[model samples]
Target: MLNNVAVAAVNGVTPFELGIFCEVFGIDRSAVGLPVYDFAVCAAEEGPLVVGDGHFGLTLPFGPERLEEADLICLPADRGAPTREYPQPLLAALHRAVDRGARVLSVCSGAFMLGAAGLLDGRRCTTHWMHAPALLRRYPRALVDPDVLYVDEGQIITAAGTASGIDACLHVVRQEQGAEVANTIARRMVVPPHRDGGQAQYIRRPLPRTACDTMGEVIAWMARHLAEEITVEQLAERAHMSARTFARRFLAETGTTPYQWLLRQRVLLAQELLESSDETVDAIAGRCGFGNAAALRHHFLRTLGTTPNAFRRTFRGPQAA
Candidate 1:
Protein backbone atom coordinates (compact mmCIF):
# COMPACT_ATOMS: atom_id res chain seq x y z
CA MET A 1 0.00 0.00 0.00
CA LEU A 2 3.06 2.27 0.29
CA ASN A 3 4.94 3.67 -2.66
CA ASN A 4 5.92 7.27 -3.09
CA VAL A 5 7.78 8.94 -0.17
CA ALA A 6 8.03 12.60 0.77
CA VAL A 7 9.84 14.47 3.54
CA ALA A 8 8.27 17.64 4.93
CA ALA A 9 10.89 20.18 6.05
CA VAL A 10 10.15 23.63 7.36
CA ASN A 11 12.51 26.58 7.82
CA GLY A 12 14.62 25.05 10.59
CA VAL A 13 14.98 21.43 9.54
CA THR A 14 17.81 19.64 11.33
CA PRO A 15 20.42 18.15 9.00
CA PHE A 16 20.85 14.83 10.79
CA GLU A 17 17.18 13.86 10.53
CA LEU A 18 16.99 15.16 6.98
CA GLY A 19 19.94 12.92 6.18
CA ILE A 20 18.22 9.99 7.88
CA PHE A 21 15.13 10.42 5.67
CA CYS A 22 17.24 10.91 2.58
CA GLU A 23 19.28 7.84 3.47
CA VAL A 24 16.26 5.58 3.70
CA PHE A 25 13.69 6.87 1.20
CA GLY A 26 15.57 9.32 -0.99
CA ILE A 27 18.23 7.01 -2.32
CA ASP A 28 17.83 4.98 -5.50
CA ARG A 29 18.00 1.33 -4.48
CA SER A 30 16.48 -0.18 -7.61
CA ALA A 31 19.68 -2.10 -8.21
CA VAL A 32 18.87 -4.09 -5.12
CA GLY A 33 15.40 -4.84 -6.59
CA LEU A 34 13.54 -2.68 -4.14
CA PRO A 35 10.62 -0.52 -5.21
CA VAL A 36 11.72 3.02 -6.00
CA TYR A 37 9.74 5.77 -4.35
CA ASP A 38 8.73 9.10 -5.83
CA PHE A 39 10.88 11.09 -3.40
CA ALA A 40 10.58 14.83 -2.88
CA VAL A 41 11.40 17.41 -0.17
CA CYS A 42 8.78 20.04 0.38
CA ALA A 43 8.52 23.21 2.44
CA ALA A 44 5.68 25.36 3.72
CA GLU A 45 6.67 28.11 1.35
CA GLU A 46 8.53 27.68 -1.93
CA GLY A 47 12.12 28.94 -1.77
CA PRO A 48 15.67 28.02 -0.83
CA LEU A 49 15.93 26.22 2.52
CA VAL A 50 18.90 26.45 4.84
CA VAL A 51 19.48 23.09 6.52
CA GLY A 52 21.43 22.94 9.80
CA ASP A 53 24.63 22.25 7.87
CA GLY A 54 26.07 25.59 6.93
CA HIS A 55 28.22 24.41 4.06
CA PHE A 56 25.35 23.90 1.61
CA GLY A 57 21.64 24.66 1.35
CA LEU A 58 18.79 22.92 -0.46
CA THR A 59 16.50 24.86 -2.74
CA LEU A 60 13.07 23.27 -2.63
CA PRO A 61 10.64 24.03 -5.43
CA PHE A 62 7.56 22.36 -3.97
CA GLY A 63 5.24 23.30 -1.12
CA PRO A 64 2.50 21.61 0.92
CA GLU A 65 0.79 20.64 -2.35
CA ARG A 66 3.47 18.03 -3.04
CA LEU A 67 2.70 16.06 0.11
CA GLU A 68 -0.69 15.08 -1.33
CA GLU A 69 0.99 12.87 -3.95
CA ALA A 70 3.04 10.84 -1.45
CA ASP A 71 2.06 7.54 0.10
CA LEU A 72 4.42 8.27 3.03
CA ILE A 73 5.46 11.60 4.56
CA CYS A 74 8.52 11.92 6.81
CA LEU A 75 8.91 14.84 9.21
CA PRO A 76 12.42 15.62 10.39
CA ALA A 77 13.72 15.40 13.98
CA ASP A 78 13.60 19.18 14.54
CA ARG A 79 10.48 21.31 14.31
CA GLY A 80 9.46 24.91 15.04
CA ALA A 81 11.59 27.24 17.12
CA PRO A 82 10.58 27.34 20.78
CA THR A 83 9.72 31.00 20.49
CA ARG A 84 8.08 30.78 17.07
CA GLU A 85 4.78 29.48 15.71
CA TYR A 86 4.39 26.63 13.23
CA PRO A 87 3.63 27.30 9.59
CA GLN A 88 -0.05 26.79 8.76
CA PRO A 89 0.38 25.14 5.36
CA LEU A 90 2.59 22.31 6.66
CA LEU A 91 0.09 21.39 9.36
CA ALA A 92 -2.80 21.54 6.90
CA ALA A 93 -1.00 19.20 4.49
CA LEU A 94 -0.41 16.71 7.31
CA HIS A 95 -4.16 16.57 7.91
CA ARG A 96 -4.75 16.11 4.22
CA ALA A 97 -2.29 13.18 4.10
CA VAL A 98 -4.18 11.32 6.80
CA ASP A 99 -7.53 12.00 5.12
CA ARG A 100 -6.17 10.27 2.01
CA GLY A 101 -4.46 7.20 3.61
CA ALA A 102 -0.98 8.59 3.27
CA ARG A 103 1.12 7.30 6.14
CA VAL A 104 2.47 10.07 8.42
CA LEU A 105 5.84 9.59 10.13
CA SER A 106 7.92 11.70 12.50
CA VAL A 107 11.55 11.39 13.51
CA CYS A 108 12.31 12.71 17.00
CA SER A 109 10.88 16.22 17.43
CA GLY A 110 9.07 16.06 14.13
CA ALA A 111 6.19 14.70 16.22
CA PHE A 112 5.37 18.35 16.71
CA MET A 113 4.17 18.71 13.14
CA LEU A 114 1.91 15.68 13.46
CA GLY A 115 0.74 16.90 16.88
CA ALA A 116 -0.13 20.30 15.42
CA ALA A 117 -2.29 18.51 12.86
CA GLY A 118 -4.12 16.82 15.77
CA LEU A 119 -3.28 13.46 14.20
CA LEU A 120 -1.52 12.14 17.31
CA ASP A 121 -4.40 12.96 19.68
CA GLY A 122 -5.35 9.94 21.82
CA ARG A 123 -2.87 7.84 19.87
CA ARG A 124 0.40 6.48 21.27
CA CYS A 125 3.43 8.36 19.93
CA THR A 126 7.09 9.03 20.86
CA THR A 127 10.00 11.38 20.22
CA HIS A 128 13.54 11.48 21.54
CA TRP A 129 13.23 10.33 25.14
CA MET A 130 14.93 13.58 26.16
CA HIS A 131 11.97 15.46 24.69
CA ALA A 132 9.27 13.20 26.06
CA PRO A 133 8.54 15.51 28.97
CA ALA A 134 8.26 18.61 26.80
CA LEU A 135 6.11 16.81 24.23
CA LEU A 136 3.81 15.55 26.98
CA ARG A 137 3.66 19.06 28.40
CA ARG A 138 2.70 20.55 25.04
CA TYR A 139 0.41 17.78 23.77
CA PRO A 140 -1.35 16.34 26.77
CA ARG A 141 -3.68 14.29 24.59
CA ALA A 142 -0.83 12.29 23.05
CA LEU A 143 0.29 9.03 24.67
CA VAL A 144 4.06 9.22 24.65
CA ASP A 145 6.46 6.36 25.25
CA PRO A 146 9.87 7.41 26.61
CA ASP A 147 11.69 4.09 26.46
CA VAL A 148 11.53 2.76 22.92
CA LEU A 149 13.17 3.84 19.70
CA TYR A 150 9.84 4.23 17.94
CA VAL A 151 6.10 3.56 18.26
CA ASP A 152 3.94 2.45 15.34
CA GLU A 153 0.28 3.04 16.18
CA GLY A 154 -0.86 1.62 12.84
CA GLN A 155 -1.37 4.77 10.71
CA ILE A 156 0.91 7.34 12.30
CA ILE A 157 4.42 6.33 13.41
CA THR A 158 6.84 8.31 15.63
CA ALA A 159 10.46 7.62 16.47
CA ALA A 160 12.56 8.40 19.56
CA GLY A 161 15.76 10.27 18.69
CA THR A 162 18.22 11.53 16.10
CA ALA A 163 19.50 8.04 15.25
CA SER A 164 16.23 6.47 16.24
CA GLY A 165 14.99 7.92 12.96
CA ILE A 166 16.98 5.16 11.28
CA ASP A 167 14.92 2.54 13.06
CA ALA A 168 11.69 4.25 12.09
CA CYS A 169 12.71 4.63 8.45
CA LEU A 170 13.84 1.01 8.21
CA HIS A 171 10.41 0.13 9.54
CA VAL A 172 8.85 2.05 6.67
CA VAL A 173 11.03 0.05 4.31
CA ARG A 174 9.91 -3.19 5.88
CA GLN A 175 6.28 -2.13 5.59
CA GLU A 176 6.58 -1.20 1.96
CA GLN A 177 8.86 -3.85 0.47
CA GLY A 178 9.66 -6.73 2.84
CA ALA A 179 12.11 -7.82 5.49
CA GLU A 180 14.69 -8.79 2.93
CA VAL A 181 14.67 -5.36 1.37
CA ALA A 182 14.76 -3.62 4.71
CA ASN A 183 17.72 -5.68 5.82
CA THR A 184 19.44 -5.05 2.52
CA ILE A 185 18.90 -1.34 2.92
CA ALA A 186 20.12 -1.49 6.49
CA ARG A 187 23.29 -3.24 5.42
CA ARG A 188 23.83 -0.57 2.80
CA MET A 189 23.40 2.05 5.46
CA VAL A 190 25.71 0.16 7.86
CA VAL A 191 23.24 0.06 10.76
CA PRO A 192 21.48 -2.87 12.33
CA PRO A 193 18.51 -4.01 10.26
CA HIS A 194 16.67 -3.50 13.50
CA ARG A 195 17.98 -2.29 16.84
CA ASP A 196 17.93 -5.09 19.39
CA GLY A 197 17.75 -2.66 22.32
CA GLY A 198 15.56 0.15 23.57
CA GLN A 199 16.12 3.64 24.96
CA ALA A 200 15.47 2.24 28.44
CA GLN A 201 18.58 0.14 27.93
CA TYR A 202 20.49 3.41 27.60
CA ILE A 203 19.39 5.62 30.53
CA ARG A 204 22.53 7.82 30.27
CA ARG A 205 23.91 9.70 33.31
CA PRO A 206 21.43 8.07 35.66
CA LEU A 207 23.53 4.94 36.16
CA PRO A 208 26.09 4.97 38.99
CA ARG A 209 29.80 4.73 38.22
CA THR A 210 30.51 1.11 39.11
CA ALA A 211 27.19 -0.21 37.75
CA CYS A 212 27.17 2.05 34.72
CA ASP A 213 30.72 1.18 33.79
CA THR A 214 29.87 -2.38 32.84
CA MET A 215 26.25 -1.77 31.82
CA GLY A 216 26.95 -1.79 28.10
CA GLU A 217 29.00 -4.96 28.35
CA VAL A 218 26.34 -6.53 30.53
CA ILE A 219 23.62 -5.60 28.07
CA ALA A 220 25.48 -7.44 25.33
CA TRP A 221 25.59 -10.53 27.52
CA MET A 222 21.94 -10.24 28.48
CA ALA A 223 20.86 -9.91 24.86
CA ARG A 224 22.84 -13.00 23.91
CA HIS A 225 21.33 -14.97 26.77
CA LEU A 226 17.61 -14.09 26.63
CA ALA A 227 16.71 -17.67 25.71
CA GLU A 228 17.82 -18.70 29.20
CA GLU A 229 15.79 -17.66 32.21
CA ILE A 230 18.18 -15.26 33.95
CA THR A 231 16.66 -13.84 37.10
CA VAL A 232 17.37 -10.56 38.88
CA GLU A 233 18.93 -12.61 41.65
CA GLN A 234 21.19 -14.24 39.09
CA LEU A 235 22.05 -10.91 37.43
CA ALA A 236 22.87 -9.54 40.86
CA GLU A 237 24.97 -12.59 41.62
CA ARG A 238 26.84 -12.03 38.41
CA ALA A 239 27.36 -8.41 39.35
CA HIS A 240 29.00 -9.68 42.57
CA MET A 241 26.62 -7.85 44.87
CA SER A 242 23.80 -8.88 47.22
CA ALA A 243 20.38 -9.27 45.53
CA ARG A 244 18.82 -6.35 47.44
CA THR A 245 21.72 -4.05 46.71
CA PHE A 246 21.81 -5.16 43.07
CA ALA A 247 18.10 -4.61 42.61
CA ARG A 248 18.27 -1.11 43.97
CA ARG A 249 21.46 -0.35 42.09
CA PHE A 250 20.09 -1.75 38.85
CA LEU A 251 17.02 0.46 39.20
CA ALA A 252 19.23 3.46 39.89
CA GLU A 253 21.50 2.45 37.02
CA THR A 254 18.90 1.69 34.34
CA GLY A 255 15.74 3.51 35.48
CA THR A 256 14.06 0.08 35.11
CA THR A 257 14.06 -3.25 36.86
CA PRO A 258 15.94 -6.37 35.82
CA TYR A 259 12.66 -8.11 34.96
CA GLN A 260 11.58 -5.23 32.73
CA TRP A 261 14.96 -5.15 31.04
CA LEU A 262 14.90 -8.87 30.31
CA LEU A 263 11.40 -8.73 28.87
CA ARG A 264 12.28 -5.86 26.54
CA GLN A 265 15.46 -7.55 25.36
CA ARG A 266 13.57 -10.77 24.74
CA VAL A 267 10.98 -9.00 22.63
CA LEU A 268 13.61 -7.09 20.71
CA LEU A 269 15.53 -10.29 19.91
CA ALA A 270 12.29 -11.98 18.89
CA GLN A 271 11.48 -9.13 16.52
CA GLU A 272 14.93 -9.21 14.95
CA LEU A 273 14.87 -12.94 14.30
CA LEU A 274 11.30 -12.79 13.10
CA GLU A 275 12.26 -10.21 10.51
CA SER A 276 15.70 -11.33 9.37
CA SER A 277 15.18 -15.06 9.48
CA ASP A 278 12.49 -17.49 8.36
CA GLU A 279 11.22 -18.74 11.70
CA THR A 280 7.89 -19.75 13.16
CA VAL A 281 6.23 -17.82 15.99
CA ASP A 282 6.57 -20.81 18.30
CA ALA A 283 10.23 -21.14 17.47
CA ILE A 284 10.92 -17.44 17.87
CA ALA A 285 9.19 -17.38 21.24
CA GLY A 286 11.07 -20.40 22.43
CA ARG A 287 14.36 -19.02 21.23
CA CYS A 288 13.71 -15.69 22.91
CA GLY A 289 12.71 -17.45 26.19
CA PHE A 290 9.02 -16.62 25.87
CA GLY A 291 8.22 -20.38 26.10
CA ASN A 292 5.51 -20.20 23.41
CA ALA A 293 4.04 -18.05 20.67
CA ALA A 294 1.12 -16.92 22.83
CA ALA A 295 3.48 -15.77 25.54
CA LEU A 296 5.52 -13.89 23.00
CA ARG A 297 2.47 -12.09 21.67
CA HIS A 298 1.39 -11.15 25.18
CA HIS A 299 4.74 -9.59 26.04
CA PHE A 300 5.03 -7.98 22.61
CA LEU A 301 1.69 -6.23 23.11
CA ARG A 302 2.27 -5.38 26.74
CA THR A 303 5.62 -3.80 26.06
CA LEU A 304 5.69 -2.84 22.37
CA GLY A 305 1.90 -2.45 22.11
CA THR A 306 1.70 -4.62 18.99
CA THR A 307 1.02 -8.26 18.06
CA PRO A 308 3.83 -10.50 16.87
CA ASN A 309 2.46 -11.15 13.39
CA ALA A 310 1.57 -7.50 12.95
CA PHE A 311 5.02 -6.47 14.09
CA ARG A 312 6.58 -8.98 11.72
CA ARG A 313 4.44 -7.79 8.85
CA THR A 314 5.56 -4.25 9.54
CA PHE A 315 9.18 -5.28 9.96
CA ARG A 316 9.42 -8.56 8.03
CA GLY A 317 6.62 -8.12 5.52
CA PRO A 318 4.05 -10.71 4.34
CA GLN A 319 6.45 -13.53 3.83
CA ALA A 320 5.86 -17.07 5.06
CA ALA A 321 8.34 -16.54 7.87
Candidate 2:
Protein backbone atom coordinates (compact mmCIF):
# COMPACT_ATOMS: atom_id res chain seq x y z
CA MET A 1 0.00 0.00 0.00
CA LEU A 2 3.00 2.25 -0.05
CA ASN A 3 3.11 4.70 -2.97
CA ASN A 4 6.79 5.27 -3.54
CA VAL A 5 9.71 3.13 -4.80
CA ALA A 6 13.35 4.16 -4.53
CA VAL A 7 15.75 2.19 -6.77
CA ALA A 8 19.44 2.27 -6.00
CA ALA A 9 21.45 3.08 -9.11
CA VAL A 10 24.77 1.86 -7.82
CA ASN A 11 28.10 2.38 -9.54
CA GLY A 12 28.27 0.71 -12.99
CA VAL A 13 24.54 0.62 -13.31
CA THR A 14 23.37 -2.04 -15.75
CA PRO A 15 21.17 0.53 -17.46
CA PHE A 16 18.84 -2.00 -19.08
CA GLU A 17 17.73 -4.00 -16.03
CA LEU A 18 17.62 -0.85 -13.93
CA GLY A 19 15.43 0.62 -16.63
CA ILE A 20 13.06 -2.32 -16.22
CA PHE A 21 12.31 -1.02 -12.72
CA CYS A 22 11.47 2.31 -14.34
CA GLU A 23 9.15 0.83 -16.94
CA VAL A 24 7.17 -1.62 -14.80
CA PHE A 25 6.83 0.09 -11.41
CA GLY A 26 8.16 3.61 -11.74
CA ILE A 27 5.99 5.09 -14.48
CA ASP A 28 2.53 6.27 -13.47
CA ARG A 29 -0.22 4.02 -14.87
CA SER A 30 -3.13 5.58 -12.94
CA ALA A 31 -4.77 6.92 -16.08
CA VAL A 32 -5.21 3.35 -17.19
CA GLY A 33 -6.69 2.47 -13.79
CA LEU A 34 -3.49 0.77 -12.70
CA PRO A 35 -1.57 1.62 -9.54
CA VAL A 36 0.81 4.51 -9.73
CA TYR A 37 4.22 4.64 -8.04
CA ASP A 38 6.28 7.59 -6.95
CA PHE A 39 9.55 6.50 -8.51
CA ALA A 40 12.98 7.98 -7.83
CA VAL A 41 16.38 6.91 -9.15
CA CYS A 42 19.03 7.48 -6.53
CA ALA A 43 22.78 6.98 -6.45
CA ALA A 44 24.70 5.99 -3.31
CA GLU A 45 26.83 9.04 -4.05
CA GLU A 46 24.89 11.84 -5.67
CA GLY A 47 25.72 13.14 -9.18
CA PRO A 48 26.93 11.63 -12.48
CA LEU A 49 26.07 7.91 -12.56
CA VAL A 50 28.04 5.72 -14.96
CA VAL A 51 26.07 3.20 -16.98
CA GLY A 52 26.86 0.02 -18.87
CA ASP A 53 28.44 0.19 -22.32
CA GLY A 54 29.10 3.93 -21.88
CA HIS A 55 25.40 4.62 -22.23
CA PHE A 56 24.73 7.82 -20.24
CA GLY A 57 25.40 9.66 -17.00
CA LEU A 58 22.54 10.57 -14.66
CA THR A 59 22.21 12.56 -11.43
CA LEU A 60 19.52 12.63 -8.79
CA PRO A 61 18.69 15.32 -6.25
CA PHE A 62 18.04 12.79 -3.50
CA GLY A 63 20.41 10.08 -2.37
CA PRO A 64 19.48 7.43 0.20
CA GLU A 65 17.11 9.94 1.92
CA ARG A 66 14.45 8.60 -0.44
CA LEU A 67 14.92 5.10 1.03
CA GLU A 68 13.09 6.19 4.19
CA GLU A 69 9.99 6.88 2.11
CA ALA A 70 10.15 3.90 -0.22
CA ASP A 71 7.65 1.07 0.03
CA LEU A 72 10.16 -0.98 -1.95
CA ILE A 73 13.90 -0.58 -2.31
CA CYS A 74 15.60 -2.00 -5.42
CA LEU A 75 19.23 -2.87 -5.99
CA PRO A 76 20.08 -3.57 -9.62
CA ALA A 77 22.60 -6.31 -10.45
CA ASP A 78 26.36 -5.98 -10.37
CA ARG A 79 28.28 -8.89 -11.86
CA GLY A 80 31.63 -7.58 -10.69
CA ALA A 81 30.76 -6.48 -7.16
CA PRO A 82 31.84 -8.41 -4.08
CA THR A 83 29.62 -11.17 -2.75
CA ARG A 84 30.44 -10.78 0.95
CA GLU A 85 30.98 -7.10 1.57
CA TYR A 86 28.16 -4.70 0.82
CA PRO A 87 29.02 -1.25 2.19
CA GLN A 88 27.94 -0.71 5.81
CA PRO A 89 25.89 2.43 5.13
CA LEU A 90 23.83 0.80 2.39
CA LEU A 91 23.30 -2.32 4.49
CA ALA A 92 22.10 -0.15 7.38
CA ALA A 93 19.66 1.64 5.08
CA LEU A 94 18.38 -1.73 3.81
CA HIS A 95 18.08 -3.02 7.38
CA ARG A 96 16.25 0.12 8.40
CA ALA A 97 13.89 -0.19 5.45
CA VAL A 98 13.09 -3.83 6.18
CA ASP A 99 12.64 -3.14 9.90
CA ARG A 100 10.06 -0.50 9.03
CA GLY A 101 8.07 -2.98 6.84
CA ALA A 102 9.49 -1.98 3.50
CA ARG A 103 10.50 -4.78 1.11
CA VAL A 104 14.02 -5.05 -0.26
CA LEU A 105 14.71 -6.59 -3.68
CA SER A 106 17.69 -7.30 -5.86
CA VAL A 107 18.13 -8.17 -9.51
CA CYS A 108 20.47 -11.01 -10.61
CA SER A 109 23.74 -10.55 -8.74
CA GLY A 110 22.02 -8.03 -6.55
CA ALA A 111 21.04 -11.13 -4.60
CA PHE A 112 24.73 -11.29 -3.74
CA MET A 113 24.35 -7.97 -1.95
CA LEU A 114 21.38 -9.19 0.07
CA GLY A 115 23.06 -12.54 0.75
CA ALA A 116 26.20 -10.83 1.98
CA ALA A 117 24.14 -8.68 4.36
CA GLY A 118 22.93 -11.89 6.08
CA LEU A 119 19.34 -11.04 5.18
CA LEU A 120 19.05 -14.13 3.01
CA ASP A 121 20.31 -16.40 5.78
CA GLY A 122 17.15 -18.45 5.87
CA ARG A 123 15.36 -17.25 2.73
CA ARG A 124 14.81 -18.74 -0.69
CA CYS A 125 16.04 -16.71 -3.65
CA THR A 126 17.63 -16.83 -7.12
CA THR A 127 20.20 -15.00 -9.22
CA HIS A 128 21.39 -14.99 -12.83
CA TRP A 129 22.05 -18.42 -14.33
CA MET A 130 25.80 -17.98 -14.58
CA HIS A 131 26.14 -16.85 -10.97
CA ALA A 132 23.60 -19.18 -9.37
CA PRO A 133 26.15 -21.80 -8.36
CA ALA A 134 28.49 -19.28 -6.83
CA LEU A 135 25.63 -17.69 -4.91
CA LEU A 136 24.51 -21.04 -3.52
CA ARG A 137 28.10 -21.99 -2.68
CA ARG A 138 28.72 -18.63 -1.05
CA TYR A 139 25.59 -18.83 1.10
CA PRO A 140 24.85 -22.44 1.93
CA ARG A 141 22.15 -21.39 4.36
CA ALA A 142 20.27 -19.72 1.49
CA LEU A 143 17.94 -21.96 -0.51
CA VAL A 144 18.66 -20.85 -4.05
CA ASP A 145 16.60 -22.10 -6.95
CA PRO A 146 18.73 -21.35 -9.97
CA ASP A 147 16.30 -22.15 -12.76
CA VAL A 148 13.29 -19.99 -11.93
CA LEU A 149 13.13 -16.41 -13.12
CA TYR A 150 12.24 -15.01 -9.68
CA VAL A 151 11.13 -15.91 -6.18
CA ASP A 152 8.56 -14.08 -4.06
CA GLU A 153 8.65 -14.58 -0.27
CA GLY A 154 6.02 -12.02 0.73
CA GLN A 155 8.17 -9.31 2.40
CA ILE A 156 11.35 -9.99 0.47
CA ILE A 157 11.97 -10.97 -3.15
CA THR A 158 14.89 -11.84 -5.38
CA ALA A 159 15.17 -12.48 -9.11
CA ALA A 160 17.38 -14.26 -11.60
CA GLY A 161 19.89 -12.14 -13.46
CA THR A 162 19.17 -9.20 -15.78
CA ALA A 163 15.65 -9.34 -17.19
CA SER A 164 14.40 -11.64 -14.45
CA GLY A 165 14.15 -8.47 -12.39
CA ILE A 166 11.25 -7.44 -14.60
CA ASP A 167 9.50 -10.69 -13.72
CA ALA A 168 9.95 -9.94 -10.05
CA CYS A 169 8.60 -6.42 -10.54
CA LEU A 170 5.54 -7.71 -12.39
CA HIS A 171 4.96 -10.22 -9.61
CA VAL A 172 4.87 -7.28 -7.20
CA VAL A 173 2.41 -5.47 -9.43
CA ARG A 174 0.13 -8.50 -9.63
CA GLN A 175 0.21 -8.91 -5.85
CA GLU A 176 -0.46 -5.25 -5.08
CA GLN A 177 -2.65 -4.18 -8.01
CA GLY A 178 -4.43 -7.42 -8.97
CA ALA A 179 -4.34 -9.41 -12.18
CA GLU A 180 -6.43 -6.91 -14.13
CA VAL A 181 -4.08 -4.01 -13.51
CA ALA A 182 -1.05 -6.20 -14.07
CA ASN A 183 -2.55 -7.30 -17.39
CA THR A 184 -3.21 -3.69 -18.29
CA ILE A 185 0.42 -2.78 -17.63
CA ALA A 186 1.47 -5.77 -19.67
CA ARG A 187 -0.72 -4.56 -22.53
CA ARG A 188 0.79 -1.09 -22.37
CA MET A 189 4.27 -2.56 -22.25
CA VAL A 190 3.49 -5.07 -25.00
CA VAL A 191 4.40 -8.10 -22.92
CA PRO A 192 2.77 -11.24 -21.59
CA PRO A 193 1.00 -10.55 -18.32
CA HIS A 194 1.94 -13.69 -16.48
CA ARG A 195 4.24 -16.69 -16.92
CA ASP A 196 4.08 -19.27 -14.16
CA GLY A 197 7.46 -20.54 -12.98
CA GLY A 198 6.53 -24.13 -13.61
CA GLN A 199 7.27 -23.78 -17.33
CA ALA A 200 10.39 -25.43 -18.64
CA GLN A 201 13.53 -23.33 -18.38
CA TYR A 202 15.69 -25.55 -20.58
CA ILE A 203 13.42 -27.25 -23.04
CA ARG A 204 16.09 -28.45 -25.44
CA ARG A 205 13.76 -31.03 -26.91
CA PRO A 206 10.01 -30.66 -26.86
CA LEU A 207 8.48 -33.55 -24.95
CA PRO A 208 6.06 -35.65 -26.91
CA ARG A 209 2.83 -36.92 -25.39
CA THR A 210 3.45 -40.56 -26.24
CA ALA A 211 5.36 -42.97 -28.41
CA CYS A 212 2.58 -42.91 -31.00
CA ASP A 213 0.03 -40.20 -30.11
CA THR A 214 0.86 -36.58 -29.36
CA MET A 215 -0.60 -33.41 -27.93
CA GLY A 216 1.31 -31.78 -30.77
CA GLU A 217 -1.87 -30.63 -32.48
CA VAL A 218 -3.06 -28.89 -29.35
CA ILE A 219 0.22 -27.16 -28.57
CA ALA A 220 0.52 -25.88 -32.12
CA TRP A 221 -3.04 -24.62 -31.90
CA MET A 222 -2.28 -22.91 -28.60
CA ALA A 223 0.76 -21.17 -30.04
CA ARG A 224 -1.12 -20.09 -33.15
CA HIS A 225 -3.98 -18.63 -31.17
CA LEU A 226 -2.16 -16.87 -28.39
CA ALA A 227 -4.09 -13.62 -28.95
CA GLU A 228 -7.42 -15.41 -28.81
CA GLU A 229 -9.40 -15.43 -25.60
CA ILE A 230 -8.76 -18.79 -23.92
CA THR A 231 -10.07 -20.50 -20.86
CA VAL A 232 -9.52 -23.82 -19.15
CA GLU A 233 -12.96 -24.87 -20.23
CA GLN A 234 -12.25 -23.86 -23.81
CA LEU A 235 -9.03 -25.81 -24.02
CA ALA A 236 -10.55 -28.73 -22.24
CA GLU A 237 -13.38 -28.85 -24.73
CA ARG A 238 -10.87 -28.79 -27.58
CA ALA A 239 -9.14 -31.80 -26.13
CA HIS A 240 -12.57 -33.42 -25.52
CA MET A 241 -12.21 -33.53 -21.76
CA SER A 242 -13.99 -31.95 -18.84
CA ALA A 243 -12.38 -28.84 -17.34
CA ARG A 244 -11.42 -30.54 -14.11
CA THR A 245 -10.17 -33.63 -15.89
CA PHE A 246 -8.24 -31.61 -18.47
CA ALA A 247 -6.60 -29.40 -15.86
CA ARG A 248 -5.22 -32.41 -14.09
CA ARG A 249 -4.22 -34.16 -17.31
CA PHE A 250 -2.58 -31.00 -18.68
CA LEU A 251 -0.42 -30.60 -15.59
CA ALA A 252 0.50 -34.26 -15.74
CA GLU A 253 1.35 -34.37 -19.43
CA THR A 254 2.88 -30.94 -19.90
CA GLY A 255 4.35 -30.40 -16.46
CA THR A 256 2.51 -27.07 -16.22
CA THR A 257 -0.96 -25.58 -16.14
CA PRO A 258 -2.86 -24.86 -19.33
CA TYR A 259 -2.48 -21.11 -19.00
CA GLN A 260 1.23 -21.44 -18.23
CA TRP A 261 1.81 -23.67 -21.26
CA LEU A 262 0.26 -21.10 -23.54
CA LEU A 263 2.41 -18.38 -22.03
CA ARG A 264 5.59 -20.39 -22.54
CA GLN A 265 4.75 -20.97 -26.20
CA ARG A 266 4.06 -17.29 -26.66
CA VAL A 267 7.38 -16.42 -25.06
CA LEU A 268 9.22 -18.98 -27.18
CA LEU A 269 7.69 -17.65 -30.37
CA ALA A 270 8.45 -14.12 -29.30
CA GLN A 271 12.07 -15.08 -28.59
CA GLU A 272 12.41 -16.59 -32.05
CA LEU A 273 10.92 -13.51 -33.69
CA LEU A 274 12.99 -11.22 -31.55
CA GLU A 275 16.09 -13.02 -32.69
CA SER A 276 15.51 -14.09 -36.35
CA SER A 277 13.00 -11.50 -37.48
CA ASP A 278 13.78 -7.84 -37.95
CA GLU A 279 10.34 -6.77 -36.81
CA THR A 280 9.84 -4.14 -34.16
CA VAL A 281 8.61 -5.25 -30.75
CA ASP A 282 5.10 -3.97 -31.37
CA ALA A 283 4.80 -5.91 -34.60
CA ILE A 284 6.33 -8.95 -32.96
CA ALA A 285 3.81 -8.76 -30.16
CA GLY A 286 0.92 -8.66 -32.57
CA ARG A 287 2.37 -11.48 -34.60
CA CYS A 288 3.12 -13.58 -31.54
CA GLY A 289 -0.34 -13.00 -30.05
CA PHE A 290 0.66 -10.73 -27.14
CA GLY A 291 -1.59 -7.91 -28.54
CA ASN A 292 1.01 -5.11 -28.41
CA ALA A 293 4.62 -4.25 -27.69
CA ALA A 294 3.79 -3.39 -24.09
CA ALA A 295 2.24 -6.78 -23.54
CA LEU A 296 5.25 -8.43 -25.12
CA ARG A 297 7.54 -6.39 -22.89
CA HIS A 298 5.62 -7.52 -19.80
CA HIS A 299 6.06 -11.21 -20.62
CA PHE A 300 9.58 -10.68 -21.88
CA LEU A 301 10.47 -9.03 -18.61
CA ARG A 302 8.83 -11.78 -16.64
CA THR A 303 10.64 -14.54 -18.51
CA LEU A 304 13.88 -12.87 -19.59
CA GLY A 305 14.15 -9.93 -17.14
CA THR A 306 15.37 -7.55 -19.84
CA THR A 307 13.74 -5.25 -22.39
CA PRO A 308 13.18 -6.22 -26.01
CA ASN A 309 15.89 -3.87 -27.16
CA ALA A 310 18.34 -5.13 -24.60
CA PHE A 311 17.58 -8.75 -25.38
CA ARG A 312 18.00 -8.06 -29.05
CA ARG A 313 21.33 -6.39 -28.39
CA THR A 314 22.59 -9.38 -26.48
CA PHE A 315 21.23 -11.85 -29.00
CA ARG A 316 22.79 -10.04 -31.91
CA GLY A 317 26.10 -10.17 -30.08
CA PRO A 318 27.31 -8.03 -27.19
CA GLN A 319 28.43 -5.20 -29.47
CA ALA A 320 25.28 -4.82 -31.55
CA ALA A 321 23.92 -1.86 -29.65
Best by lDDT: 1
Q: Which predicted model would earn the best TM-score?
A: 1
TM-scores of the models, in the order given: 0.64, 0.61
Cα displacement (angstroms), candidate 1, residue 62, comes to: 1.4
lDDT of 2 at 320: 41
Off by over 4 Å in 2: 82-85, 198-321
lDDT tens string, model 1, 1-321? 777888888766889999888888888889878767789988765557767654556788778788989899998965453224677888888888888888988988888877777888999998887788888888899998887889998779999888889998899889877899999999999988886545653443222233467456666667678899888777777778888998887788778888888887787787678777778899999999999999998887777656777767666556743
Clashes of each: 1, 20
Question: Residue pairs in steric clash, candidate 1?
Answer: 128-160
Residue 57, candidate 1: how far off, in angstroms? 3.3
Per-residue error for 17 in candidate 2, Å, reads 0.9
Cα lDDT of model 2 by residue, 167-208, tens digit: 788788888778787788888988777654421233232533
CA lDDT of 132 in candidate 1? 83
